[model samples]
Target: MTRKLLHTALVLSLFLPGCRLENLSADQLDLITNSVSSTFKAARPISDEEEYYVGRAVAAKILTSYRLVNNRKLTDYVNLVGQAVAIHSEKPFTFGGYHFAILDSGEINAFACPGGIIFITRGMLDAVSNEDELAAVLAHEVGHINHRDGIGAISQARWTEALTTIGSQAAKTYGSKDVAKLVGLFEGSIDDVFKTLVVNGYGRSQEHAADLASLNYLAATGYDPHALKTFLDRLVARSGGSQGGIMKTHPATRDRVDNVAANMPEQKSDAAHFSERSRRFASILGK
Candidate 1:
């Protein structure tokens, strides 16, 4: 476990500022010390902190392509709901934790960066019929984060090189020369995650995995897992002639719907609570 933790810290160290190393608790510091004796060639794991920095870079790259929505109330509502459901995920506490944002575009898409930063487009938000549906959408993205699918996009060579360099250094703090090498690796890492997640999209198996994770999170949080199927059904119908955003990035809706149906959890409906949740959602989005 110490080696695993140290490997994670080393992977995260690429973009981490030297000053932040001072903030590490005794345990994290000890892990770094122990890592000096270990060879990084065998193992490389992206730590929570490293994931946060990588996710931030990816988020910045995404912002260049899409404008962010400036509605404070709606953004707060999303963050609240996203955090509530994210708490039940396997890897819950990332470096800075999860943050939910909205894009101003009308594209039917959502993006989940390496760590926990998630962005949902306006059109996607508009498609959700209720709070449960919105939760389902967010849960899917959370699944991606839980599975570390974003980091999986990074090249094997990059991971090996970065981890080897950090492990050789013996501490999170690095010299200026080390920093230069890391900066190059950092740029490459960012490009890997951005191109794979935002451009090429995850593979079919990954999408299925995320969808399964979404169902589990939704079920664990008491949100109807069926809401995912319903939302995807609507999204497919609403996807007109142009296959942009999710239509372009995600797998076929019919396939996703079937998979979701096969793995959906059973829950007794509470009409009263459901109605109240729906009312709040409508009021918030002015639907």
Candidate 2:
């Protein structure tokens, strides 16, 4: 079987928990192929280097639409919180390592491109009440990067087409045709991730998985596991009827808050941490 088909089979088997892989029938295989084909044409395992380049492209696309925030203190603080949480993530280090930046937009949005390039809008920064809450959000984005959610959005067909064009070329460096094909694939890949992270949002399952991973990062970094829930609660209350920014880009706030509560760790008072962190946050963003 091709790599994309193999991946599809494995993913199908996962959802069937406890079912033997060998038990998969031809009909099931056909079903999987049809379902996947609608969304992807061909796929190959992306290397760390490829992911880094893709991430750079994605970041560049985002920069065209939004300016970077200019506050050095806020930027440094965000990186401090992001790095701390990232160090405790499932994938602690990445090909290019984690880098955090603030977008000047007040859109209450954050994005995690592949290869650990994370961005948070100034609106999101102002929305989070404390350091732990910021850590919670950043950790969730880190989970997306660790899981390679962005790369997974690319249609398998794009990779196959790009590879075919490259293989046809005889030059050591990409010729014009090869470069054009590669650039098209790269642009498609970026659009896939951009549409998910900004336009449509990830599926509920992906969002929940990231939330769980965020909790794990929080626990490992000595932040309150409830920090995410706290932030979500604020989001829910403030959302009132209109959904904007993060609400547009993430799962339902109520469902997420409930899930976090159900899976919350044993109560450990981080009142002191919250107190101290909020002071710093307020100093920067406001009361």
Q: List the residue pairs that clash in candidate 1.
A: none
Tens digits of per-residue lDDT for model 2 on 104-177? 99798899998999999988887877788899999999999988888887855466665455345323322344
Indicate the residue-level lDDT of 76 in model 1. 98
Instruction: Score every model by TM-score.
Output: 0.76, 0.75
Off by over 4 Å in 1: 1-43, 157-186, 240-242
Alpha-carbon local distance difference test for all models: 0.79, 0.79
Q: Give the range of the ten consecutive residues with the poorest summed lDDT in model 1.
A: 34-43
Query: Model 1 compared with the native: what TM-score?
Result: 0.76
